[model samples]
Target: MKQDDTTEGAAESTDAFGGLTPAEGLELLRVGELTVQGRLAAASNATLYCTVSDGLRSAACVYKPVAGERPLWDFPDGTLAGREVGAYAVSEALGWGTVPPTVHRDGPFGEGMVQLWVHGDETVDLVALARETDNEALRRMAVFDAVVNNSDRKIGHLLPTASGHLYGCDHGVSFAEEYKLRTVLWQWQGMPLTDDALTRLAALRARLADSADPLRQELDRHLTGPEVFAVRSRVDLLLRHRVHPYPSPDWPAVPWPPV
Candidate 1:
């Protein structure tokens, strides 16, 4: 699958797995201002860093194909372009400090996921960051992610900013109502959820119909109904039960390509 970059919105560029190029595939990135620095990692698929123009701003970007391009167990459609964008959308709203603002860019050259460039150090885990928080916001990030039905969040996806803040990446496989809660963030696997976190879960459930909802389109048909309910229940569970991180074994052990 190939990727494309379009300053125009991706309204016309929608497709199964966001419609990668038939031939050029990875090479279609020549039109962008950002140059391919290097291959970050190659597990689920591929990832690369490049320059991108979002709205009126320009910044470095991580580019990669939508889920349909790669074959991981989590994404049944093999593509969750809509869902990945949804996760980023919600993350940005709450100032989660985890997901950077993301957009779906496409054009004559390439098409796929394009997100704001996050310039910072990639260190620190949720547990280490959780220690410093009084409200336990660190632990809540995991619960919030799970409530959103994040399907893939290995250790490496969580990064530390130079300022000591924690950030999350690689949520393309999120928002499925089933057993998609898989991550290494559950150090205290059986911990209870805080009141504030519970509220956010309700907010997310209420916002499930958000016309701008990113996951609404990408969420699988098999999971469409339950997935929406899952979002509601996951929020309730985090609010009611002390849901800890479950074992993410069948989950892919490799890092998602950082494109």
Candidate 2:
């Protein structure tokens, strides 16, 4: 099997198959047959590159099986896949498009997180992009990482696509009840949130409060009660403070091998 496709790498080109809406993509990933094409060896987890097909439509995707997940002393065994899905849910709620269409479902390797593969723009300098203060996309992602309590947001996770969209992946270590945010995009630290961001956060906070909301239901399925509650708490804090958070002194300010 071919290898060497890191999340930072220009992935197997799939721009032609990128026409599907997020809803359509989610449906395909949910019920389609997944055939593993290769392994993304750079991933810490068992991340398999695959194609999902419902006969008429097919697209490249990344599948990280729960069985292949490495144990972290802090996270419960077999829960990483769910956290990945939970992150996708939050991204969708925020309407930020930071995460690709991802779903947790049964695959060749058993149940895991199946995410649409993103073909990153090879020309963008990710290091410089991460350090920029005025890049709206990266700033939005920083807020996202804060809300999810993402413990690992390396420079390599940034995906700047040719379609003028910025996305990020590798969120299997997110949504802890404690404040564990660590990231490379801290240029907006302590800055007041933009009006647009506050509007989105308010909508998300309202949706999260409604127990009957689909977002709440989906989050419940993937996250523990306290973890889900913690997401709400984070949003509340952001709205109350109305500013991007500072790095937590209790946790590492940045991930190792930041790139």
Candidate 3:
């Protein structure tokens, strides 16, 4: 997907604080501008962290990047920052529930974005949370992930807020528009769609049909037209082919473990 779009120094960073841990990342901050902090959570190809700014006085920022992440394929640089920004922007534009404002930054660490921290009372476990899958809210959450082409959404990424609203994190690999719908939400398969759920999908369909106008401009450019149509097809398929068992728990993890 044109991962080669940016080269080193092409995208700038405000400041560089190298090799910081999640705890350490919270300590470093600057206000008004985005700052590159230390690595937070590391996956096969990316790290999660709090991009800090001292002036802001806010301690923690949460984001996932493929900074040290390796090439999943022959094309494009596998770095996380730029790709996440694209996917996040696209998802946001399509009017889905997604990460809050991500600050696109130019910095020494290369191009990347910062995500608003999701406050979860405890660590997330999909199977555990699956217990609550029947709840309309949770079901909607899974379905949203599916529709967004959110391939990296693991059970771990769904944070359970204190209020019980499940927040999704790490969406770098979303919006490919083909073979991109990945997640574990089949537990509610065949469950009748609430008016709200059906409405959300219907609304998304309305947006996609207007792809000439573009529901998400970023996706319009990044994903091919046919691919975007495929995405729409998958969404329709999910609603139609879906069985009562919910998503087949049999699907293996999205190949990229963490966004």
Highest-scoring model, lDDT: 2
| lDDT per residue (tens digit) for residues 45-93 in model 3 | 4455654556634545654443555665522465345546555544444
- Which candidate has the highest TM-score of all? 2
Q: How much RMSD separates candidate 2 from the native structure?
A: 5.6
TM-score of 1: 0.65
Better of 2 and 3 by lDDT: 2
The lDDT of model 2 is: 0.86
Error of 1 at 107 (Å): 5.1
Please list the residue runs of candidate 2 whose C-alpha ends up more than 4 Å from where it truly belongs after superposition.
1-17
Ranking by TM-score: 2, 3, 1
Number of clashing residue pairs, candidate 1: 18
lDDT of 1 by residue, 1-259 (tens): 1111221232122121123321122223333444455546653555666654333334455766553256656456644555656676566444443565555555323556655444445343444443343434456567657767675766556554443444567777787655656555556566666555566666766565564565444333224666667666665666566456565576543334311
Worst 10 residues of 2 by lDDT: 1-10
